[model samples]
Target chain A: MDDKVSIGMDSRRITTTQRETTRPFSLKRQPRLGESIIQGFLLFCGVLSMFTTIGIVVVLGSESIAFFRQVSIVEFVTNTVWSPQIDEFGILPLLLSTLLTSTIAMFIALPTGLAAAIYLSEYASSRARSILKPILEVLAGVPTVVYGYFALKFMTPVLKAVFGEANVNIYNMASAGLVMGIMIIPMVSSMSEDALSAVPRALREGAYGLGATRLETAIKVVLPAGISGIIAAFVVAISRAVGETMIVAVAAGAKPTFTFNPFEAAETMTGHIARISGGDLSYASIDYNSIFAIGLTLFLMTLGLNMVSRRLVRRFREVYE
Target chain B: MTTLNDEIKSGLPQGEAARRNVASRRRTGAIWRTIFLSATIIGLIALSLLIYNVVNEVFGYVATEYAVDPATLSDKPIDELNKDELVAVLQDNMRANAFRTLERDKPMADRSESEVYDLVIERVLKPQTLETWTLRDSWFNKAAIDAQVASEFPEAKLEFRSWLTAGFLTTPMSSDPLRAGVRTALLGSLWMIAITILFAFPIGVGAAIYLEEYATDNRFNRIIQTNINNLAGVPSIIYGMLGLVIFVRTLEPLTSGRIFGADSGNGRTIVAASLTMMLLILPIMIINGQEAIRAVPLSLRQASYGLGATKWQTIWHHVLPNALPGIFTGTILAVSRAIGETAPLIVVGASTFIVTDPDGPFAKFTALPIQIYNWTSRPQPEFAHIAASAIVVLLVMLLSLNAIAVLLRNRFSKRG
Candidate 1:
């Protein structure tokens, strides 16, 4: 199928060319049977993926609509207390917790990840880079649940011991956010490293010839060139942090109270969904449907972030080739 | 671009002052680079420290805890020995150790034999030391202890056993370290991964191949592409809710419809969870697969057609083989991701209490992450040891799978 399409497309290109080929188009048309099979395979993938998205939207939308009918839109959106046990199943606290963790996570991750990217792209030798890159990526591969356990069992006790009992809780957002930050560092490093490497070498050499130091060249030239990718990395990392659940569920306590304090326990949308579903909530109940409503909000936030990053990446792509 | 300083600096480069300035600048640049280099090294060391912490905690249990000396057992046939003989052998060792300790402390002669015997039992049988506390090995049996006292140092030879052993794999979790094992959880994880792969692969790849090879680049294709990228970024927990609605409630009648009059689908079966994960990663697979297909060189298709092959023939014979490497890379990565995912599985209902191995996709199941979460949530100290061991197993599994993917990717890249 691919061959037929390519051949048909290629023949069309050939016919339009000023110089004509000897082979007639009819000979190529014979391959259409085989081409259609390949085309069918391709079409199947596209349609299946399309159906999946539609399935998600339809399933989520219908349930969310059912939920919203019971819980007013204002109460669900604006209220600070997110006690689903109450009549008002507000999502504000979950959103706050998600934002607090992801924001703090990015605050720690962005600088370290970017610096690592710079060192790999500009300073490190090939031997060092080959050894280090995989080790860095290993962070991403470690299951988030492991990080969750480490945060709750290891990090929480250490935080309390060092900073005092009043400063930390067993399910504090700080430890979860800190460990979550560590998990996201590799995502930023790898993406930013690729972007920095993609920056044309000519730009670096030109800066060097003009008497700028390697550090200056990296900061002023390579960084500027890779800014779009850097932004994309941050955006993706934040989205990842927001979407993360097991870590927050295990480490961050299930108290969905709105608070700016990192030392206190909080809940995220993903965490709440896990907690609620794990409970014996009946399928037809408002709480069950409310999960769908919260899911829609989470989905929309991440989708928005992904779309923005995608646009930024396309706009910033250096046509070096 | 011209300045007095530029001319002076350019012209003075041949002199000592210029040489010193250049050397100083070079020194500063090297120092700055050295700092950056050290930071990278430091970052890696931190990662190593984290791995070391987990490994140390796990190996520490395997090392100091519950490891009985094999020499103590002396290859005794316990089945031939009666219960009375077993009791006699145990009592003899109990008396010998107590008497020996009493002889060493002559001032304690006023103490009763019962008191001395109780002390002996506490010291030998109790998990007094970390080593003695974990001894569940075959060597820790009464015969083993009797033989060790006779052959080895009469006083110094003692049973050191592991609290965790092969039995840990078969047993359910208990408050006591001796009873805790991951058998049920392991079976659950195996079933979960098996079902997840079965569901996710065909649909994900099918979606990928369609978009890459068949679908035209019209408004519809653009919409599909946009939707997929957006779907890829959506929180995984959302899929769980979708599954709950679609599989648990809507499709309950079909799921509960048993052919042999058995309860087939309880809404939390492996099928529901697997289907949910499949939906979650479908976008990822489609996007990755599409990229893979797009990456296949245009010349391969042209060359295949130059031989007078049909369109399907060209794709099946030439284009697909060329694209397989990239597709494999995408599939492997997607699989790795699905393996580690915890949130969606949790929301979709992975039972923590599943004891038997799943017979098929319809069976209830759990995963490593879910098990780890269950273990870590509890307050028991011994559970931490098992949790660490479980983590080691999980990491090793993920690492090996990722290594295979890397190997496959490298091979494909070379071929391309």
Candidate 2:
């Protein structure tokens, strides 16, 4: 039925347009009820995602509002102490521990993951690539809890042997960070590979044709083209490192302290929540509210990173495209 | 005349020419490429070894406990009455092996007390198995085995299932590794994952379609875009804390209903935990869906529009079908993360033990990761074996889910 109407319109327009001017945009006037319904559904989906953002902000924000009212911003920010007892509540120690662990995890993840990415994307043979890709993905597939258990039973013992029993605390941040880095290797490498692969082969060929080596072409032409993606990948990986909890909860002990020593036991924002929630706390209490407050902080940090990374991805695409 | 002699001398040094010849350069290039490829292969091998080590350790226990000791299994494999028959035969063989081991360790009564004691009688007299054996029954009695061991040879260390069994899935945790079960935890995981998918998929897919199709590329949309990305990165535990504060504490009035039986004082119900995870993974779903949507060729949209279709109609009729692959892929990724997550659930007060499966979404529940953690942390070494087996089960489930996701993505994209 619609095909008949379109055919009618086409014949009428063809006859009328023989002498017509200003008819280039005539197609915009068409009625498309079926099309509208599909578009409407898609729009509804998009709007719903936006609401998720709103929901997170409102729910987390409202509860955290109560927490800030109870504890002064200065005490939470300035003080290094994090007792979270009846009289004292501080977030500084948790923040510091979170930063320290994430930083350490990045330190481990960046080199190995980048190397693996380069090897896989640029150097590895097709046979090698096919076999290696799935295996490395298996690392990501293992649940963090399994990693935590392995860290406690296996990784800790090996660390103790190397660092000695006295120095290597069972719940130090290093083991957790190291294992967490291994867990996220695929994320960084996979994203980096995507970024690198998106760099035009024309650019590499141009460099090579100019007598540059493969490594030289990658370093000078291809990597620069894909720098924005690499940066995005790095930022995303950092966010992942910060968000990681199970390994930290199990391998990194739940002693919230404002210290940078990787060897010492520490607790991250997520770890604290895990520990506290595992136990009991009264509902509507200030301590419970603190969880929301910390969540708000984590949310803000990650939100900022994601936005920046997305912008970087757009800019990176523009540069090459 | 001298030029001819010089030319001949210059041409005649064939030995020097042979000595100066270099090896084929392509072989050297091939060797380098081979080395580079081998390094990548090594990385993969290391990963396999890691998995192999964990599986090997866990299964070693299974081998000891389950493997039939051919010497004492007088009946053929089919002659056994039930599943326990093989275990019984294995036990008898284990007892005989113990006697042989003891005889090697010590001599007669005058020689050593270990040698004079009965080994076979102890295990055979009282065959006690772990809850794993609850699925099976042994023919021997406890006191009888003790007396038989004392009267015969008394030098044997009894072994049950080295690894965990299905009984571990059914039993609530115990102080003893032999008695621990993950039945409650498994049920909890099911409830949590089911609720999470129900809540997150709609919101996530909706958000993806909205951002991808309808919303103009304006500053507000950009902000929303940024927010979703960041939400994906936020540590999941924060969601747990938010759930605790919002659902357990502030909203306890709604959740703490006495519908199940008693007011068991469990504040963080499965519903609350599920919502938190839903929030945590929503961003992932949106982002993945957006990518899928973006991949659909714009030409299809133009064709629909040219046929007198509205903007919405064009997207619905022409675009969405093309983007189905991305939607499924994104949904799978989001669900996978949701299933594996343990930290946030821990934060929201998943019970360490609940004898019964959760009665409803509001009922308190335990999950597999929580159960595994509880077991592994215990002082007993046997519980570690249980944890390993549980880990295996969890990995298998995750892998299967991922496989399904890949299959869907491939099937849809292939249609495109």
Tally clashing residue pairs in candidate 1.
26
Best of the candidates, TM-score: 1
lDDT of 1 by residue, A1-321 (tens): 999999999987877783464644453344456556657665765666567667778988888999988889998889998876667687889999999988888887888788888999999889989999888877778888888887887778888999899878779888888888888888888889998998998999999998878888998889999999999998998888999998899988888979999989998888888998887778778887888888888878887889889999999876777
Q: Model 2: what is its DockQ? A: 0.37
How far out, in Å, is residue A269 in model 1?
A: 1.9
**Model 1 CA lDDT for position A312:** 92
Model 2: residues with Cα > 4 Å off, grouped in runs: A1-44, A59-62, A86-88, A258-260, A307-318, B1-46, B60-157, B160-162, B172-175, B247-267, B299-319
Provide the TM-score for each candidate, comma-separated: 0.80, 0.75
Docking class of 1: acceptable
Per-residue C-alpha lDDT of model 2 across residues A1-321, encoded as one tens digit per residue:
999999999998887786466545463466667656666765665555466567668878987889999889888778788887655678888888888878877886665666566667766778867878887777777788888877776777778899899988878888888777777777787787787888777888898787555555656677688778888988898888887878888888878877787778889888887777677677667877787778788888877777788788887674555
In Å, residue B47's CA in model 1 sits off its true spot by 2.9
Model 1 residue runs over 4 Å out of place are: A1-38, B1-35, B59-165, B170-177, B254-262, B412-416
lDDT of each: 0.74, 0.71
True contacts recovered per prediction: 0.72, 0.59
